[model samples]
Target chain A: MIISYFIYFKLQESDFAVTIFFMITVTEIEKLATLARIKLTDAEKQGLTKEIDSILTYIDQIKKATLDIDHTPIVGIVHNIFREDESRVLPPEDREALLKQAPEREGDFVAVKKIIAQD
Target chain B: MIDLKNLTIKKAHEDIKSGKYSAVDLTKAYLEEIKKKNPEINAYLEVFKDAEEQAQAADTRFKAGAATLLTGIPFAIKDNILIKGRRAGSASKILENYHATYDATVIEKLKREGAVFIGRTNMDEFAMGGSTENSAYGVTKNPYDTERVAGGSSGGSAAALAMDGALAALGSDTGGSIRQPASFCGLVGLKATYGAVSRNGVMAMGSSLDQIGPFAKTVTDAEIIFNTIKGNDSLDSTTISDTTYKTKKTDKKLTIGIPKAFLKGDGINKDVLKNFEESIENFKKLGYEIKDVELPNIAYSLPVYYVIMPAEVSSNLSRFDGVRFGLHKDGKDGIDDYFETRGAGFGKEVRRRVLLGTYILSSGYYDAYYNRANALRRVITSDFETAFKTVDIILTPTTPAPAFKIGEKISDPVAMYLEDIFTVTANLTGMPAISIPSGVSGKLPLGIQMTALHGNEALLFKAGKEFLKE
Candidate 1:
């Protein structure tokens, strides 16, 4: 009776872990290819799923290695690589040259046919 | 047996200047090679319909004494980099017919020097995946082995360089896109110190991390192109406020750092380890000391990187709606057009990243995931600071293993991500990194990667110069 209880408790723990894994999957990855405009087939999805899980597993290693979460992520001792910002006037045809490449165009503005944002 | 295909850019340039080889002749040689090998290699997305015209123009420039460093040098640029009058889709269906509004900053620079762009190369759409498998067109196979992957997201550039499709190629490295593919395809690839190259018109993945790099068969070739492209630009504010080095190489007396965390990691392949060790021994014999340095936060880069990169990607890519630019899927009337266009245009991987990015950056979870990940990104960058102190350069295996068999790790994005472990720190910390072919392991070649801090590409180039066999 005690053994059965222990097994049941462990099963529950694993099930929760799996469920959490599913949740943090960042739904953005599913749409990443679309936003980037590429296609990944179903088999590719399975491959990426397994790969992402392994990466997450390895990431879990960081929790064990460093307890200090406040440490800054960027490391060069030098403070910044900022350069002086300068605005130069683009040549007249520059915009036209670029806008011409758009599939659909409005005069002077590259015409985009649709908005991808969701409500 | 003219050995024309084996000619280096400098050698070809010399021949062209001496009138021994016309730019047209050199261009024809490459086109013939592309025609012969591209079916099996698949390096080019589209062979220029007017390659002959472009070459003739180059020959004319030579006659007029208008040749620049890249003058008449036929090369390929990754499609992500814009070129005037060329379709600039980044291997994604949504922008399948998209063209450049203007030359990308690097393209502009190269163009001034008289570089003849043969065609655009393939990539993982939006420079997302480490392998070219994510492309909507088709997977770019390894040049070394047709059945294996040429590491991406710059696979096409690497493939083109390895098989002599171009004298040199340009690719963007957003997290090992340039270096890893160079490793898989046995070529030299460099990710300039962040902002060292202008990002004026390049499609961004993670703006903070994206860098334009070069692909070539030799370190010198890579350095030549790097020299031509590197400089401070008023166009990009993030470029090093001050330039790093005037020349492409650094003086010796440099300290090389080898991160223990990576050298002793779990996923490292045996042959990769062996080649890396052998190359280190050669370097030591050349009088450089290899010190063991520890960057503890290095291990967590992927999660932080994936989270932050996609979050930024979700934001940067928000512009590609069906309404304004790119491939439009016609819908009933026009309203459904928006829905169907993006829905049909974007591929699965692209959608996944966008959606994953969307979730992370969403209001409720932004602090825990996106903000925390950004904090971790700082931590990862800081860790590099502590390590770069005692060393001028860091060396590691470019990939955990050589080119994996096609479909071996394609299904597992995490495993594929792991393949980029050795190369990501460069992106994370905004350091310059280069991958150089060390030697062949089995049927494939292994790459040795070295990195230098901001404005220190000279060290990478200097080190890369010693290993050239040509």
Candidate 2:
């Protein structure tokens, strides 16, 4: 709805601390909100702009650390998992129980707003 | 009337078996304390109505001569962990009325042992923030001081234990969620080695960093609970067995390493450093060698964690699209419906991470931000591996300071994230770490944290027990 109408813009270098006006534009935040699938009020966007700037600035320190070592092995515990090609469906009772929690349910199915609508 | 304050799982089991107190009686004692303190502390979001029924079942098991150590024990569970037929909302409104249809792997294990669950405790919404102030229900106040925060995203579980509301509680650590709270509340908290415990039913935060561990009054209790829940599960393929990261049992005293970089920083409180030094001296008195170890990449842990965690958070949280379950907000179109549901459902902190993660993983920025962070993650993790060769354990203060006033860091996201600086290294490296109460700094509790090589939790428990004695 509101998120889809917001246009995504390219992040220009001027987006950072170049000028007070260039700090974080509403267009940039709208793009991020659309990508994250969350609608932000104008007030929320203004607040987020400031918060995200500081968080990004803090995390920017990682770029300074040199990645001098080649082939940095992925952390120790990562392993490939292989399972048998078998199909196991949830029991009927459990299926019903889970379906009961859906916000919009119609008979045996969970309903949702139509996705094919054109603007 | 059973005494809830001094109760331990071991003592509770003995008293139950000796006819000193029944399981129902023990459960009732904790329930009474929960009723008394939960109103003010807000530790438990909802105390289960079936608590008495669970205790009754445990009592029946004890009567039939089928009691295990955890058979009659009562526990408070962090709301993020699923328990069949119960609400596990992760302190967010999206799942406010959602009921779990099946038990989490750990819940199934505990159920098989007949452990009585007292209630679901509060946490930061989606386990995103460092303070329980992010909880949709409300902030969980520190039991020691109501004006201050109980460190989070597992703050409720820590507060529950601190107030004797539950015997022990289960908490998930993505990055210092469990340990920092335990440190704040003055309890023993453990973050098991990555994949040492299955995360099949826990709310996904950062998949690479998530782990389930326990909060207890004593190190022995934490170990017992850890051993009961830890094992490779078919449901969670990432889990590993004790044999995977085995360490040789040495007769020589264990060597404790201190990364000098984290010890004397500008933000670190002087009292915290004092407690850490006293803990080091305690280890030396116990005949362990204290050595200064250099972990060059350890300093970059926070930035690496910030980048990597949000990337995973954005990906893992995509499942809440309002079509399947949880909250659903009607809109003119499908896309609008998603925006409305998520925007209204998630708390402010959850939305912050989701958006931050999206930006990091989006096109044109992935290589510059996310990839570089991943490379740094590898450097940080391998550095710990190298350090472990020279030292059996690494020690530090659990947090830079004790519990802060409730509104202190809420406005500053970076300031709140700094709480995890000491604890995130263990999660990054897949190593087990424990936070044991050192003493009090002023009215607030202080904790000394120790991290060991992957699957070397036995060393933590042994050292924690020896250190706690002093």
Candidate 3:
């Protein structure tokens, strides 16, 4: 198993005997920064760890009153679709613009690092 | 004193075309209205400086007898939708400096139809949270009450429409983002059939569930915008135009279905139930049949949406590497500082979902979580297919309750999730659903949600128009 540092912490409180635990996984701390596409320093990670732990603790407390997952049912309101078969192309400029965002654009294609090394 | 603010798009368009009013004149009036109302409503993040220029162009088009139904109409789009040369932040600090390099497909289509994009509206950061409070920029206030939250992640879109800042606003829905916010703000919002509108340019929250739709004060405006943008595009392979047919009519007997399972849900509010029941009576009065139906599989939607949405989110958002786009935070002074960049850039909620998604789709847990959710989604889809055979459409409360105060449920994500119970089913099954204003007596407005099978969006439009008439 590939394991990374992810931890959770307590957060805030409420009434009605409902729990309010807000745990932040260590992996989440790592991942969140990745999403913002920002880099984090070791000291900041340490700070976030404390903050997430506290948040999780609060969330856990409120959730204590609610029934566990097995007890409650899931529900939704949308339905199935069977769409018509059709082919339409986006304008050339749109196609080209999307391709332009790629790190490497080669001859109307988005060039990527070769995933599989050729034998 | 006539309330031009209350005019529908059809009426406004007719008036504009007949010289009773000019598109430029209408745009100026609305611009003034936005200037008056925006500060208190907090519905707009930025009003376009080019708005007057665009209005001039629209007026010029109208005078030349080249006005399409949407000519010169000022509309604010959720900040997520890419407009060429404009900032599309997705309400996150990370993308604060990133300008949209190109217009999204919807923007292109709307621009072609002569719709003026007045500016960008706020949203939950990367469309993560149930309330606009999660926005990194700042919370978008509810139009009815400034202190209360506008429901999200498309909260600002709904608020813009509610506050009369724009005639209609573009919003993207993944799960209940559009409908729930529309319900809270007393506007019309739609999540079109999966793949109905191309998801080419917007910052995506979930690949399978994400869709670009509209929020308008009236149903017809929603229809007008939907018609203008709905089509198949090769850029987004998922979108298809199954039913090229379109019209809004309620002349015959239409069957409306209500899931028996939802009637007994633990989280449904009593006021919501009352509002929904009244809508049912109104539908009956309008000569429609309402029936009770059962779909035991409906319960799995939230878990499924959460599972699938996060997985896709983790994938789609991978492109925002600090080296390439938006805010770049350098840590440890090297290329690998990318991790630190995201750590500093994303908000707490966006991070949580990314981790949850990565964990669920990981090597060992994929089958147990992601695969199981996919199987459950199929069951949910089948259940809807079965119901549609018996009824023309299904009607439920858009959200389980009305707007909750800013801090009311922010502490408990699971409890706050109850607000999406009525809307997730549509996302899970890739169906078209609309939230329409049911009634409003005091500050709070109530909503009735209607869902139809794929490609049956025309039926939804017809049904929605009928509801508005009542």
lDDT of 3 at B208: 78
| Candidate 3: residue B63 Cα off by (Å) | 1.2
lDDT of 3 by residue, B348-374 (tens): 677766665665677875765666677
Q: Deviation in angstroms for B254 in model 3?
A: 1.1
Report the C-alpha lDDT of model 2 over A7-112, residue by residue, as the tens digit: 1111211233332222656788899999889988999999999998877877776656656644343656557788888988988999899889888889999987
Which stretch of 10 consecutive residues in model 1 chain B shows the poorest summed lDDT? B241-250
At residue B298, candidate 2 shows an lDDT of 74
Model 2 segments beyond 4 Å from truth? Answer: A1-22, A69-73
Candidate 2: global Cα-lDDT?
Answer: 0.88
Q: Write model 1 residue lDDT over A1-119, tens digit each, in one string.
A: 21232233234332333323442333444554444443456665565555445544434332333334563444333344455578867797876765665566778876543556556
On residues B1-470, what C-alpha lDDT tens digit does candidate 1 reach at each position? 23755677888888888999788888788888888988887778988878778778888888998886578888888989888777888898888768777778898898788787888898998998888989988988887889998878988888987777888899999889999999888788999888778887789888888999888877888889988887667667676534443333456566788886545533567888888888888888777888998886676676677777877887887787676568777766455665577677777667666766766676776765666676777777767778887888888888878888878866666566667667877887888899998888888988999988777777887777865634
The full ranking of all candidates by lDDT, starting with the best, is 2, 3, 1
Off by over 4 Å in 3: A1-119, B244-251
lDDT of 2 by residue, B32-145 (tens): 999899999999999999898999999999999999999979999999999999988999998878898889999999999999999999999999888899999999999999
For all candidates in order, the CA lDDT equals: 0.75, 0.88, 0.76
Q: How far is candidate 2 from the true structure (C-alpha RMSD, Å)?
A: 5.8
- Name the better of 2 and 3 by DockQ: 2
TM-score, each model?
Answer: 0.85, 0.95, 0.82
lDDT of 3 at B262: 50
